[model samples]
Target: MATKLGKQTYQPDNPPFIISTGTVAGPFEGQGPLKDYFDHVYTDTLAGERSFENAEKEMMANACFTCLQKVNVTPQEVDFYLAGDLLNQIISAGFCALELNIPFLGIYGACSTSAEGLALAAMLVDGGFAKLVLASTSSHNSSAERQYRYPTEYGVHRKPTAQWTVTGAGAALVAGYGAGPRITTFTVGKVVDQGIKDPMNLGAAMAPAAAATMVQHFADTGRGPEYYDLIVTGDLGKFGRELAVITCASKGGFDLSKNYNDCGLMIYDTEKQDVHAGASGCASSALVVYGYLYRKMLAGELKKILLVATGALHSVTSFQQGASIPAIAHAVSIEME
Candidate 1:
């Protein structure tokens, strides 16, 4: 007996879809002068300073505004908004929506909000439920730390695997069928629980989720890693990236050590930033993909790409209860024609 399976292609029957498959940025970048301030404080050179949260919110708002402008779409034009942030109660998303005065749907995926938001928005477009949708995610180190773990004045040391929460935001608009890169593929992830207890070790905790989702994505799409120019994971950082490689190698019988890269590691050069490794948070990977790589693809630097955003599915309440941290990852494939 013989069996046959169908292959999925990028052809859309209705119309050519061009989603806000990309993003824009604001002026202020990550960390800012905090590193310099820390260095000066260590040497007793300076005394008081302003709060990083205020600065981060300002930067985030600017980023959101700039992204809205770049897409040439007004708030009224957007049918729905999907947004998330690292801050408690999603202040950034809330504030952004309040300022824009559009219908909103706030989400929480820890650091993986980018992929989740895009996935949901893509579904809406694909289902013909809405014509245009905007999705966004953001994170600020100061805000996240204060809300989840520690205070900025504590100056606590972090584990090497820990990623610095990115102080940025990224927004993209997904449109109905048009002429551009469409959300060609989506691999919904499953939550994988690993018995790692350390909150500081997010990379280790989330690595398994990234690995599981990547493997499932390849299996579902019936495609190999070679099909993509780049396979980018969200904020898995250095440790998680290595673990993901090991997981994929074990399952797929391929070495992804060289081809696999993590956005957490790429956002800020650790040596220059003195951030130990790199960045994390919801916006960490989102900004890099939307602001950097998307532009490169548009410029013909890349053809096909697979973006996997990983998140640690642990909250303050869950962590306190000694519940194991579960991680989730979502993947989307984009191609330029």
Candidate 2:
């Protein structure tokens, strides 16, 4: 049975294992520093598909397929498929699930969908309700921009705080026992609204939520910043990463300056890439956690890691209605055992 801790955290008695992972990156991401970490990189955003939306779905399906292929696990062997995306109605996840033909559980956590799915998948396996589960998420730059902000053809001037949506997908398979990292703890965050209404500044809106969850995770697990080899936030870019470090020190007295980093900052070379703030989207942390970090863990460089993926939960309708962005962060503690 999973043990609840400090109101929002859960420590699984039999921690679930992340057996395999798959990641696919887009052209722009292919030029990034961690480009070699990805299993596949698309030549173009379309990926031979007619529309960006279709291409996003293809990427997600391919990611899931890659995971299964690596472990020789058939789709029917997986008990459930948990996935989500930044698309309207989570169309990309839905289409990917349809292709996989697994029992599907669609989730929506904005950019935090990756961690959210992992947490739920771990819970199901830890509870003995599932033998194997697949968690996947994806985002496409052109498709997300058209739905959330502006169409690519418009070429609207972006603010300095605006982040580039990552065009990619990632998937991981969780099992009751496996030869990989173990998911020991999960911290679920509350929806926090800081009264910020600007849709472009997502990192600013999400930093508070990320801080709250990190604080709670530390308190619940009786651990501090020094517990993990590395602590990473999902898409808090250069500016928001600084804000998160300051907020953690002020609120929880936790100094994260030494071993902490953000996926948004690590995913792209902000100096070289045209991305203003950095990378943002479901695939931002997904690609880093499943590709780069996973490979490092396998090489015995990093034994433990804490991934806190944050999300700005606001829709086009809510933004237009002058509603503030409500953000959340889900934390997953993975350690090699």
Instruction: State the C-alpha lDDT per candidate.
Output: 0.71, 0.95
> How many residue pairs clash in all the candidates, one count each?
4, 0
Per-prediction TM-score, please? 0.86, 0.99
Model 1: per-residue Cα lDDT over 160-229, one tens digit each: 7677777666777777755556666777788888798877888888888888887777775678888888
Candidate 2 lDDT by residue in tens digits, 1-337: 8999988999999989999999999999999999999999999899999999999999999999999999999999999999999999999999999999999999999999999999999999999899999999999999998999877989678889999999999999999987999998999999999898998888899999999999999999899989999999999887789889989999999899999999998899999999999999999999999999999998899999999999999999999999999999999999986
What C-alpha lDDT does candidate 2 achieve relative to the native structure? 0.95
Q: Clashes in model 1: which pairs?
A: 16-178, 17-177, 17-178, 20-173
Candidate 1 all-Cα RMSD: 6.0
**Best candidate (score: TM-score):** 2
RMSD of 2: 0.7
Candidate 1 lDDT score relative to the true structure: 0.71
Query: Candidate 1, TM-score vs. the true structure?
Result: 0.86
Q: Residue 103 of model 1: what lDDT? A: 85
User: Where's the lowest-lDDT run of ten residues in candidate 1?
Assistant: 38-47
